[model samples]
Target chain A: MTENDILEAAKQAVVAADEEKAIEVARQAVALGLDPLRVINEGFTPGMRQVGDLFERGTMFLPEVIIASEAMVAAVAILEENLPAEQKEKQAGIAVLGTIEGDVHDIGKGIVATLMRVYGFKVHDLGRDVPLQRFVDEAKSSGAQLVGSSALMTTTMVGQKQLEKLLKEAGIREQVKTMVGGAVVTQYWADKIGADAYAENAQEAVAKALELVEG
Target chain B: MTSYPTRMGDGHAVEMSTDELRCDILAGTEDAADRGRIPALSQEEQDYLLDLFSYPGKIVGVQPGNEVVLTDDGSVNALYGAQSSSGVGVPLSRELAIRVYERAFCMDTMEVGHPDYSFKPVKPIVSLEQQCLESVLSSTIIPIYYGAMPNLALYAKPDGPFGNPADLLPQGKISEARAAQEEAAQALTRDMVYVGRKMAEVGADGFNFDTTASAGDAEFMATLQAVEELAKTTELSIEVGMAAEFVLGMHGQVTYDGVRLAGLYPHEQLKLVEKAGAHLFGPVVNTNTRRSSAWNVSRAVTFVKACSEAASIPIHANVGIGVGGVPMCETPPTSMVTRASVAMVEIARVDGL
Candidate 1:
């Protein structure tokens, strides 16, 4: 009905992880005199912020994350549809995300990617068991603002440090901000490996990304 | 007719080695003559068979499970941990691996109670339990000296990753719960060292550790440290079981409606466990067995992600023909036993046992 109602509806849809509803409400909000930027900035992003918190707390698991991310994508999908041709072509900063080699766990990475998408970050997702060079190469080619890797095991967590080394060896250390996380990854270890930042959870990753961007 | 259905130790004790007894049992089974067997065996059978077989050493790799499955490689896999009857498996053909495990684990551990069980208890549980125990004690067990006494080797998950799970998240709550639960379970087990010491005092030798479904990786290692201490003053050896929790998220605490949790969060706790020096691991997630709630195959496979996370230790996992809770399903005994056996072997292959 009103612009306020439409935005509220869109926010609820994202939190509920209802894609079709998110798209419908997003479109309706735009039609009801809501700013496209406002709907995204105020409505969709906050829902995902909560999703990140839930995931970190383990209150939400994989299926729930998938649902919430779906809604975020749906709203984004609708928003992109209404943008001017030139604006559509405009890209957000790039991010390369992956789980380190020998680690097949990807739940935390998946949440980070979805939240990044909600924030209008262009993400190149490299699924589980990613080799070190693949991360380095993606960062070089994409010129990503952040190169992120997750390793749940302490043994494999060494891959994160390796990625950072590869970045330096490739002479691109300053070009890409390397971020790493997993159960065993502490801020101290981040300093040890020269990772620019570390997110304790998916939400922290987003905040870290923002800080890294601004800094 | 000593009410064959209710006989106890119907056959004479074997003076030969358990391996020889096994051969004799096989011979008797093949004889098609008068057959006698052990009576109804509870899990207590492990101990009964240990004495019956008259072996001096602990058991190792002889297949242990109640359910069996044939892997593509022809090795036997079995359902290990908490079962009505235990199993002892050996390498048979691809086809035989399944058949043998099913017969050993899936079949009734009792003697000829059922009229159709005209087959004697002679080939029943006592022989199987003794064989399983001896195989493990004889080999899978090592005498590691922390002080002056020997602490037996515990569960190892070479496929697991490192770190306590909740550490993977930003939330202190998740890690807190995981940490607390592991602390409690392991503390309980570590204290069992005293009980084990008492058992060894009376010639019990060693007791198995049921470390399944534990919560924290740190707590597990602490428990082991405590047990290692107790062993210095006692004569007991220890065998530990791996839990679904360390590999999967706290078991009943989390599930993926249908998707794989293992695939979703590949880096959790299993690897850190190995760092603590656990050399053996066991897996046979009973989470989805018949009595288990809402859990499914997708949830079970999530543990697979932890499989490659650790290295240089053997791990064991299993499947049941009946699905969910692999514990209750009534399938052929051999398949159940083999399922458990093969899981351990696979862990050995993949984890560098």
Candidate 2:
């Protein structure tokens, strides 16, 4: 198959949520001496980005996004395996994410984490009700480029600001970027809390995370 | 059936107590068996339930779904689920059901349905509806969970009584979860049948079937089946309550080759509900914080307008704002309420709702 045909097939595989087909296409592209990064960036990533777009536009539900993420992850894993160590290591940015303390709503956080992984972020998801100290400590330990916190309730959103304060107290505030989001989180609230960025939804979170890491 | 008490024969204007009136109303409607089992409602309670149904506009009640189950020492822990060791799990007594209905009504809520925090047992729905219809206003609505989350205490059990969270699995070992969810959905339908029958027996208005907490298309469709089943069995109007975002998700958001899209927007959701033979619609907007500013108000207005436009039946916006223990904004509560109300009115007028 031509290079463009292979890339389109890979993208379609992910969109169709055919994990095995995605992996098979990625393997074929690698065997064809196609650039592995191109296979990921031009093929898998675009497909995942479309999935993210569908989700953001309310055209996709969590289950579809999740299945697509799985397909993307499967294909990306194959492509990353074909990359040289140095290039592969440098390709994806590291990040940490979680639902703040006193909140158990993990659906949104789970979506963000999955999308971040799809977009080639080395994500450390701390799950729900993560304490403020854990966020800072995990970011410091993992050397995350971005720390994202989600809070579905206004009461628990306090933990996001607390996490920022803790990062400062640890003298690492300047070392990392902080982003906040959830159902009740507005850009105004983000500004009020002095967060580096605010994402209204998972797609926006991915975009902001990219801007923070790349910029 | 008992007859209504006539006005005083002497022509002297008599101030009859509410209890006397209620007693007379109960005499004709309630049989000896029912009277012995359920106590007569006080005048104040009757008025509380009636006033909500008679409100000028749509009736809305918001529950944050945050009611927690406390340990014996009173520390709040897990969510109040079906098996929680609290007042929630116990079958509600006849008197308690009346009080529950009364409290919901007093909150300007037309429907007496909430999450695990408060629910009437399926058995008492008929008696409760009967009492309300006889002494109070019609149009009382009882809300039922169509696809409820599995009782956490029953998590991982093969025969669990509700939809297990694990049922959303992608592949193998999901059969048990699917079976469990189907069983739960069937159970819910059976309960709906019981409730619908009772409501019909008493000449009560109707009930609402809510699927807000459903996890995905499977759970949602299963719940819809239950709703359809209830419709087939009853002539009383049934209102369907769905999560706004879930509806949005189902309309066109997610696509999987083999997966059917269950997402719908407000209008589409209302259409589906209408096709199911329901005559009322409740679009629940459950936010985690208070509407402290115009931003929040604008969001509410946008959501309300969408729901109002899509609904052919009366739309009840079940809005849950502000967590229980959260501190309020600097703005006073009264001011916040006024601002929110004004925003809603302006939006309604602009949209011609």
Candidate 3:
């Protein structure tokens, strides 16, 4: 198959949620001496991005996105394994993501985490209902450049502001950028809470995380 | 009061006091002998039965001629014929009652009856919680589904094609693909019914169907139908919760389709829900720091007002606060209380109170 054909096959595999097919394709690309990064950027990433778009457009639901993400993760693992240590080390940035305390809604955060991984960012997902200090501690411990918090309720979204305050109190506010998003989180609220960035959905979260780290 | 032995429908004759008979009748378990007699119950006896059934409890056992004991076993609690006291009786604020009345004509004529007399209570403005409780007691419809997250894996058919986008399309023919989608949608509805059954078993007053996770019009409608079926059997009110944006169709996000799809706009969706016999509308506002941000607060207020105006049912605005917008934690207790107070005031204002 042509390189484009191989990349297309990988994309189709992820969209099809065929983890074995995605891994097989990634393995074949590795055996063919294809650049792993090229395969990821051209193949798996696009597929996952499409999944994210489909989810946002209400054409796909959470389970589908989750399965697609699993496929991509399987493909990426195979591809990353073939890459050299130095190349593998070069990621966009480290990020700490979690649902704020008292909120168990993690689907949105999980989506962002998966998308960030596809975009070459190392993400530390703290799952749902993460403590305020743990966010700061995770960022400090992991040397993370970005911290993303999600809450599906207005009552718990206040933790985003509390996290911002805690990060500043930890004296590392300048070192880390914060991103907040959820069912109710708006960019205006993010700004009001002093978060560095806000994303409406997972796709925007990837773009914003890239900008926050690169810019 | 005279004591008498009455034969139950099961051919069992039991002796009971007038009060015991009144309790049995109020509880809707009167013996066959007295089923159609319609005995006169004092106001105190009526109120006692009304309060007993207002909260969550069930009659566990009936000591034939003596007493009917109620236990807190989470059974369906319903008041059969309690006198309705407009706002106080149903526990709703007058503004909310007015809004509900304006939208749903069925509510206004809803009779709260007793063995002696049935009267429509005057609608008085009351607190939201009291209103919800009163609505539950009077109507026996408790709204469930706030913060309810069903596990998707539980719904997926084993050995069935799911979680695969390829399965979403026809392999070679449109008919085949359509069948797959239909089956998938049916599976989703089954899951919703399962959730609804659990909610009903716990004596939910009503159910708020969560629309955030719905994939498209097909799945959304399927879930609605499933909940509607539950409501039919359980006699619980149905409330549909949608993101405020989805309801308003803001940002050009509204998808237009016929009744089958409901056009994906807020107003259209509201109409469809009403047509489907929903009793309440919950518009969920997605914003952080709901109390602090004027924009967020105003947006929520506007959305609630729009819902109230569009539908006759009571509008329940689901707004979050704090870091991730979860209402339960991390934020100070005062902040949550303040946000709730502010939201209530704003909602009341929208009702022109």
The DockQ ranking, best first, is 2, 3, 1
Q: What is model 2's DockQ versus the real complex? A: 0.10
Question: Measured with DockQ on alpha carbons, how good is candidate 3?
Answer: 0.02
lDDT of each: 0.47, 0.54, 0.53
Per-residue lDDT of A1-215 in model 1, one digit per residue for the tens?
87667667777787777888888888787677666767876788777777666555444543455567777777877777777777766545689999899776664576577667656688888877899999988888988988989886656788888888889999989988888886546565688888899876567888888778667
User: Could you tell me how far off, in angstroms, the CA of residue A178 lies in candidate 1 after the best superposition?
Assistant: 0.4
Off by over 4 Å in 1: A1-3, A84-86, A90-92, A102-120, B1-353
True contacts kept of 1: 0.00
- Name the candidate that leads on TM-score: 2
For residues B169-252, could you state the per-residue lDDT of candidate 2 as single tens digits? 322224444455455545544555666666566554555555343344444454455457667876666656554434433212
What is the docking quality class of candidate 3? incorrect
| Model 3 ranges with Cα > 4 A deviation | A102-104, A117-120, A153-155, B1-231, B234-353
At residue B71, what lDDT does model 1 achieve? 18
Cα lDDT tens digits for candidate 3, B162-241: 43222222111224433444566576667556655544554555555543323344445555566567767776666565
Off by over 4 Å in 2: B1-214, B222-237, B245-261, B284-312, B317-353
**lDDT per residue as tens, model 1, B165-187:** 32223222344434444444454
